[model samples]
Target: IVQTYVENTRLIWYRHFCNCTLINGKFIFGYYRLIPSYGLELIVEILLNTRLISISSTRSNTIRKRLHICQPFINKHHFEYREIIDIKTNESIYQLNLVVVSSNKDTTLIRLIENFEREVLKYPNRHQCFTLTILYFYQKNQTINQIYDLIHQLSIKYTSIIRLSIINQNQINYNRGLGRQLASKLFSNKQLLFFLDVDLIFTGQALDNIRQLMIHQLSISSCTVYFPIIFSYFSSMFNVNNRTVIDINSNIGSFSIYGYGNVVVRKQDLDKTGGWEINNHEWGNEDVNLFQRFSESSSECNVFRTVEPGLKHYYHKKMCNGIVNRERQKICYDADGVLLGSQRNMIIIPYGMSSISTIDCSSFEPYDKPISTWKTLVTNLNAAERDYVKSYLGQSLVEQCEEIEGEIDSLLDIWRDYRNETVANCTNPTIHSLAEPPVLRQRLTTEIEFFVKHI
Candidate 1:
């Protein structure tokens, strides 16, 4: 499957490593490999064509191992797995099987699947070392859907590497555990299974990392599962062109530490652990429950976890109405609010402003840091930034500062009353609600927004 795909597509632009420089028609590279031993210009052209050399069409090191927008930026999955060999190296490439779960209402399923094919499978190869299984869950009445037809087409096209399965949904809501179990059973072999979400964009290197970790450390001696932390992108509004929104300069996307669903485990362990627990608890909280089960069960699983920068969860609207419980709703709301825009962009100014002024909305009072470091409109601005702020707020910096000082007096009174109410009725935080609380930042943002708008 991999050889045929590689030959047909010629998309292995990312697999090779070359850190050489071309100077005055002379190839100057540090590393000495069998290729350099050939001593022919034709070899360089061949290497360049196969993407084995680091040289691009412009004769630059395209695959240098520095932080790149193309890399991490996520990889592999499973059940009956297949082995793929590199056509160049003649080495066996690791195969990962993907089990993607989604409901019929997930409108972006088709588009995301297309993205998965384009970004991962067809090229440099996320799917090169991976097999895919789409577990489509649908209500009995809403059985016939376009997703069905699309999956059918995919199954035919990628026959060696793809399978499409459907589960009859008795309830309107998706039972993630049930869907996973159904998919696991469909696997012919006890393959390593990746419980994947429908809306993830992964990289080939990420897949390679996953496969290497599992292939090396995974043992039936004890249960093992790989839980990779995924980076969630900000809203599409901030990225109209959607060109590499990688947070190279500043933190652009939110690193989701609470989300525990996207995971990799063996089929045997999943069965031994009694599969995913049926959670009547929180919405989209199935992964958390599963993780807990893996950690706290009778036969404890040795779960492996690492921050995978390549695994990215793209922005999408959430159905957080009756579906999510109180805690779940808050998480959903937080994710949705973040996707609406980051605090920096969401503080949209009114009237005929620059139409594109950046809001330096700093992080909230870090639970550990001193609150004085907070970036209010008044404090912490350099001289140049202060001048920019003066124009940004459409008022004198000194006058605005003076007005905000007065405004603080009124806000303190409101705060005192709120503090008393909090003292009167605050309770211990629950497990589900105990991660990163946005209370301080939320208030700070509100106050800053109000002051700026009024000014």
Candidate 2:
């Protein structure tokens, strides 16, 4: 079947337009070059029957209008996979080989693995059809360290779901590409391979869409791969890391249009397309390199860059592993400095009152609109609004602001102290320095700005 795909590709590709090898020679006609255009339709005779698949049909027109995908930089479709969603049983055309790259003995693996079991493995379609390989960082002693100890527990708890592949190096620096490439080698070249990180949380619904796209949209002849646009959270402070935030609409994260990781591809397709760049290590540009290669106009490979719902990247303190090129270093630092999603207004209203429960972990959405009257009354108590709170709510407002000023107002100061302790706790200086103290302060200020609508 692979050889047949290669043969068909060779016959169809024009060397003047694409990277594929020529069958006999080059095509002199420019019109033939138009065959590969995104919107252009052509005949593709496949097994059992013939179907007319339109080019790049996104499920949601609303998100596409907001997505702003440049010409070919990112694949621009949002497929909800509404057809397969209701099927509690999802049997796909291919078996999924999920490679979750982990290093540094982190306890967050517990959240990741458990969430995977609850969300992805809950469906009969995935639980039976998937093989999860954890590419763990090197460890000599499992008892002393929290990260290693958790891995030990994981091996026992998820024996059915996990196959541990420990890297035999001290690995002071994280080589994401190397870890992913190594994991890929453990699987059959013909099987479907998904490269992932521990910070990602995805639902069974997302898996259904991914499988749908992988089976139907991907073709071996064109070397197609899928990079789903995941929603990335701002900070753990906004209740984003709370595993209970399952609904994508309820999520406080923004869609990362530029993120090219979280890939789903057949191992055979990956091998043919110059697999991952093993040399580009340190949590940078590794994913981007593959995306860029196929995004080119002349490339024979077809990349299905779609914004599939249900995948989420939880917040973490990120630092450029200091090994990527100057360009990626800038990209990494710029990513580190971002935080507008934590706006209080975006938090409160989006989920209505359930957000109060999600954020505090102590409340739930009420049966009635209990607080609506007072909430409306205070805001309208004279246009000046300075003395408005004292009108009805009284000392309640003053007392709460006092508590906020005394406690929550010093979030930056508290973070700085925590950063210092973590140095003693500060192993995360890059994240704490760039993402926490400054960005938290910035987010808080920005929230006030967004609320007040003033400078």
Candidate 3:
């Protein structure tokens, strides 16, 4: 029995148009050049198993429509191993060909290891061909001993997927992270590239979940943000005076959800752009970083979103490591500034009741509804309105205002005294000036960059 193995047993691709290498060394649009032309028949043959196998990383309408048009021809041929593979390894030890998805950019080894465990080892797929291989950012750390051990363990049970070099981290740039990963994934025998996040739990239906996210054009997409926990906390401590809001305008085309900690991109678009943005290293902002980059750079970055129903985010535990609670005051001031800028009506409409919540009720219900009875009763100026309301005199507004004014005044004075004490403890000449009185530093920094220039 003679068995033949084709180089591309699976075809992972994105939804958008891409340029492919032609026989004569020229480049042309892959979808446009191939779909309506003679390549359609060839694709049909691959689909039906005449002489090739067709597997895509996406389930877009473009791919679906094209596949449907060639359905009759595809149905004619029957190949033995033509399938869309969602890999999951369950037998503990299995040798498999692994494709490390990365770019010469921002993917740190720590981030890559997290991605590997979440996207690869966490899943249970035994369909891969290579004996044992690992995909990741191999530069962030010097320890390959642990990876070697994992591979050694896996090689004992399965003989298909085998170990290879750890993948490179993506090079930071504008929008080429996905493209780089695609190029790397294309070289492997298996047409699967696990695009894992630095912070994600790779449990339960990991492969299937990734496949669903791949439908929206890109290889994979994480769930939308719904549980407003992050936003709510930020608002309460940082922007207490302002309504907690998530900007929908920021995500024009890409569906913006609030809670997804990460996603797994497929291999198709990875080939075109190279990999994730290496330029963006700022924490709290990598999600939009790659998505925005790919949307602009690759004409073929068809990515999608998947919901990790019960997924856990382990990386978020470190959020409080270097943060300062005092910094939250800045957020409060900024939010108040926006509310003041928008006029007083920008206040949130009271939901259940007005007294218990900070929400203002002037914008809705009786106030807006002129014909409503509640409106008439409240605004109606009868004998009660005519009566001089000065009947209930208490502390004067000036006195009350003066009390608030004194409290704030005393608070600032105490801050000044404490600040002076802090200045004495700091011996470092470099940071000695930072201990200056808050008001004094504020005034000096505004007038000149003398301190900044020195530090």
Candidate 4:
């Protein structure tokens, strides 16, 4: 039956490695199906073109060592167990099979069987050594049990080749930010970071394409490219001249090829200019800032995009009418409050304006540092530029001091009476209820408008 199935799916079997050519004629026919869906077509295509580099005994230790270096950024499931074949059978199997066997008697078995067949037909050729990592942000309200369930499910589906990790802002030990932080830690040792977004599912030859571009003549040292995720959206957004290469030497420009997320960096050069700043608050424009910093430091930081190999698509929902500014201010205030109250001897700037007129901290406090130190740090600026910022902060400080004094007085009064306790009540439920209706309508309207506007 196995041989017959392999024969029926000749395209997939042809690409599978090993010395199975001689044993092919010794098997029998298996039950069959007549029609297949688009999902099945994708599975077959992905299988025929994708490459998986097997973990050899000699190279396994090297990979394991690299994983250990990322230990600070990784969670418990970041290094997980992969199922090997039984000693007697000597045939390796996926955990998905065990799942199917256990639930064989269920009514949904047929659907499972079809999906399993499709999956089995996918990824027949293996060229690159790939490991899956799942990242989740640690939230105060999130339950550990729920996190464990999510990890377990992904582990089983990906055949225990998956690793799980969490990033928590409160933990000083781990830098809890976004992709750049994760990439900096993970790729410290690796020559290339290849910081792919979480939603990108490897279909086929993605790594191979990376290698080719690196060796290509037009490719520069610090070039990053992307394969398309969604067709029409990508084409319209990129203004596709087809297989066109964009030069982003000026800014950290992004590219959408074949329709997907951008491939962020060429790790070696990115590290030299400095990895992501651990100081940036909850994600908004951090990528742009990083790109600007890189461009200012190095001439090689360029972006070149290309088409996706097998037309893979990914989608993620975005925020809608959510109070992003309010949340950012809350985080900044909390961070400042904690820093001021902590025993750490470092000079804590409870409130300070950014060098570029952006808000760095929640409030502006006068710096007690030496004039010489401030002058040195604010290099590349004229004497007048320095004086202007200092003068502005001095005036702002007086206003902030008055507000703080009022707040202190108010708190003292609240301690005397219980009325202020009402202000501490939870606001999440109300915020969520208010966010839902408009958010749904807005998303639908935006998607439709995007189509209408483009077409």
What would the TM-score be for candidate 1 when compared with the true structure? 0.53
Which candidate number would show the highest lDDT if scored against the true structure? 1
Please write out the lDDT profile of model 3 over residues 1-455, one tens digit for every residue: 00111112222212222322111111111121235443342211111112212254322211111222232224534735434454344432122223333333233433444444455544445233222244444455445566556555655544444444444443422223432343344343324444333333333354444433333222232211111111111212112244323221111111214432244443334434444554433233344445544434123333333333334332221222233444443332332222121111111111121222232223222212212222232234233221211112113522332343344335446555665676678766664344435564454333222211221
User: Which stretches of candidate 3 lie above 4 Å from their native place?
Assistant: 1-144, 162-164, 167-190, 212-261, 279-287, 294-303, 316-455
Q: For candidate 2, give the lDDT of residue 418.
A: 62
RMSD of each: 21.0, 18.4, 22.8, 26.0
Using all chains and alpha carbons, the TM-scores for the candidates as numbered come to 0.53, 0.54, 0.32, 0.33
State candidate 2's TM-score.
0.54
Model 2 Cα lDDT, one tens digit per residue, 46-111: 111112224554222110001111122234464343332332223333667678887663666767
lDDT of each: 0.56, 0.55, 0.33, 0.34
Give the C-alpha miss distance for residue 357 in model 3, angstroms. Answer: 18
By TM-score, the better pick of 2 and 3 is 2
Pairwise lDDT winner, candidates 2 and 4:
2
